[model samples]
Target: MTLLASLTLASCSTILNNLPGVYSIDIQQGNMIDQSMIDQIRPNMNKRQVLYIMGSPMLTDAFHPNRWDYLYSNQPGGEPRMQKKVSLFFDGDRVIGIQGDFKPSALPVIKESEETTVDLPPRDLEKTMWEKITNLFGIDDIDRSTESDRLTEPGPATSEPTINYPDDSMPR
Candidate 1:
């Protein structure tokens, strides 16, 4: 009975040791305002009209009711994903101007450009298969390995450090 218990404990320890690292996910949405929609907002537009056109502002300053900000961001996955932002400014009760990191030229043009027609390299099925096999067998040298190095090393001791503070009983 003791031998069986020891074997079971050892197996459980091995299984726990081999467990993968924790992963996190953040679900993001697309921008609420597109360039075309922003373009429709013209200078000297009424505050109510602007609100009707662009919907509710994303943010408003506590002290300044005249200024309104519309902001949005998204990451579609993979390294170096694209990021976008837009801001509109208002003075008094009218929209005085619109300004942000986004440029009108950078916005998707309606015209058919030659760059859009450029052909991409055809995917090699054999290469993909080899990569999958490598990944499955843990042969890939890339950081994509499921085995986490964190568990292999000893973690810092949980003992809390002592802190000293001056006594508050003394009169000023």
Candidate 2:
């Protein structure tokens, strides 16, 4: 009877070990914005009118109260995610400019469009080969070495700096 019980227990253990691991699927809802709603906005529209048309802004900068940013991002499965960002710049209470992923040319004509053009420097093709080789190997000098011994050899002078903030009232 003891032999039979031991064999049964061992069989149960083996079955349990062979069983597939527990896995859970998590599906997150997409946050892409409706482009039709954005197209309806006019240049002369007030804050209340804009809010009523486009809903609440996603991000608001405290330093620059005039700028209202709306961002919508979504990722489906392992596919590449999509992002839509709209920035409305206000001069006092009136909307001055509107910029985003949507085509500006198709937007309603404004009397005084305050659009600012940005020019980015051209990329160098010489370093492309080196960058591709490094990325393929997935090897980074920073990751391979410890924080303390990155570029410089370990010594008293190379030690981490200690921060000391002096009180304003104390005499030097």
Candidate 3:
């Protein structure tokens, strides 16, 4: 009886929405705007600057060139739905007013306080990869000119290897 019930329930679990071959679809459409984007908007900002701050408007009416609308809607898998709308009113090339579903928060003014220094030694930025490798191998202290010169200087002897082929004198 228990086994029969378990099998029935298992078969029912694969029905409708949770069917085995069904793939859950992600529905995301429109520009995603946030509060930070809204905060960037300032009065009298140029159209180009406003466009750069907020992504391209979702709706632009041909007759109303002065008005631009930004819209966003997202319904991701297993997540709650989200929507944002912002309207920018422009006079000629400049922004006149901004009205939307979001509020622009006051930006925090950073105060420059006393300057502090770490007193650490200046970095040696000129060090090459070979120099770093040599330092890692603990060969930095030694005056390794022969090794260093051999590495940097390119000549015929270093370029190609002489492969030894068996001459006639050897046992065939």
Best by lDDT: 3
lDDT of 1 by residue, 87-160 (tens): 66777777787777654443443534566466789886754676788889888785644347656767667778
Best by TM-score: 3
Candidate 3 lDDT by residue in tens digits, 1-172: 9999999888887465555656666677777788778877877889899878887889999999899998888876535787878889999999888788998777843446698978889878887788888889888786556777887887775667866757766545
Q: Which regions of candidate 3 fall more than 4 Å away from where they truly are?
A: 1-15, 18-25, 78-80, 108-172
| Candidate closer to the true structure by lDDT (higher is better), 2 or 3 | 3
Backbone N/Cα/C clashes per model: 0, 0, 0
Candidate 2 residue runs with Cα over 4 Å from true position: 1-32, 104-172
**Candidate 2 structure quality by residue, lDDT tens digits, 1-172:** 9999999999998776556764333344323456666666767778998888777888889999999888887654434666788888898888888888764446564346688999999987854575668878975453444456764765567568866767775546
Estimate every model's Cα lDDT from 0 to 1.
Answer: 0.67, 0.72, 0.80
69 Cα displacement, candidate 3 (Å): 0.9
Question: What lDDT score goes with residue 2 in model 2?
Answer: 100
Compared with the true structure, model 2 gives a TM-score of 0.43
Candidate 2 lDDT score at position 116: 92
CA lDDT for candidate 3: 0.80
> Cα RMSDs of all predictions?
37.9, 31.0, 14.7
1 against 2, candidate with superior TM-score: 2
